[model samples]
Target: MLTSGRKGLEASARGTTVLLAALVLASCASGEPEAKIEHLCNVADASEEEALLRGILRADDYTTDINNRTSRVVEGLERNLRDIGPAKETLSTSMCAYKPTPRAGSDRARFEFGWVPRTSKDAEPLLSGGGRFDANGAFGESNYFQTRLFVRCDMPGDLAEPSKAAWLYARASYSFNIGRTDIDQAAKDRQTALAYLMARRVTDALGCENKPLEKPPVVKPAPTP
Candidate 1:
């Protein structure tokens, strides 16, 4: 009787061990997909940054010595936006032609950044009415294979009054050529990164109370042409 009772207890212990192992396996299986999704959405690396800068500089076929100037112009715009007060009215700057030379084609890259007071009756209505912004508070549009990204973040503070609210906005676009019906995923990713970079700078500078923008997803490489 004693040996039989001992055997029964041993069997029960084995069953409990097996049950615990199964539960652990189930937990891991459920968590695997989320881990993979996070890995896939990793932030842009050095290569993507380099690609965007080079692409912007060589956006058009007409070659000129405006590469340095283009870089400086972009940097200056960011600085100006960051140095200004959060409640300031709309302050915007754009770079249309990097060089003085006339271009044979309309293909070009443009970078724009600005901020608008949410109190403005005219601008507030247009921005608030648009339901197109995504979870990251950004919207993108593509035309003629050109990718454009717009990002906005409303300032957070005691300014509950509509008259006191303000928002920061950034836009970036690059057009390779005209008449293409399909958009390039890689280009879109780069522009999205650029826009987020600008938005982050301004938000940090102004000390906005909003959360950081979500990282752009990694896009598969476009097929070779």
Candidate 2:
């Protein structure tokens, strides 16, 4: 005859295995699937910093210069939108296309671009969210900062029209107090980022990359982002 102890041990082992199997199945059902990750910009290269400083600046002269360019791009973009109204055959555009001016001996943000009609490139975006203030300065007992920014993006051209592109853009002015030396160059950078964010939101809305980005994605400043 089989011993009672042996039978008891066998029964416990069976119970444990059943419980483990149930737990595993439950976990699989409840777990979320892994998400695909995309790296936007690499922060290590200092060359990009120089490029940004050269191409992007917040001085009044640069602001005016950028705004002027923006106007031309916007005109083109608005026209494309109008033409594409209810046209089901046209494929959407997602990014801007313009021939950048050659970099010369350090010029003020006063640069010119040859706008290209209806183009799409998955260029890395520097702007895509609301303005975030980060620079801090000193004012005797208080700290403050003055910032100005202008940003613009040319929307991808209509797939139907190879000669057209759209535009989305933003501008920012900020003077604030943090009263801390801890404030850094990021303050200015955030303002710049705000402009790009506006443009990105607009491009995303064109339903080119995927479905259009959600409405009112960013207007005012959000967190450090």
- Highest lDDT among the candidates is held by which one? 1
TM-score each candidate: 0.41, 0.23
Candidate 2 ranges with C-alpha deviation above 4 Å: 1-167, 175-184, 208-225
List model 2 lDDT by residue over 50-146, tens digit each.
3443234332111112232333444444555556432222222222211123322332222111222223221112332323331111000101233
RMSD of 2: 21.9
Q: On residues 55-170, what C-alpha lDDT tens digit does candidate 1 reach at each position?
A: 54442222222222334444454455445454554446553322212344544554455555544432322321112223254544433333333445434443323313444455
| Stretches > 4 Å off in candidate 1 | 1-47, 52-91, 95-107, 116-135, 145-164, 214-225
Ten contiguous residues with the weakest lDDT in model 1: 34-43
Cα miss at 33, model 1 (Å)?
Answer: 53
lDDT per prediction?
Answer: 0.42, 0.32
- Judge candidate 2 at residue 218 and give its lDDT: 28
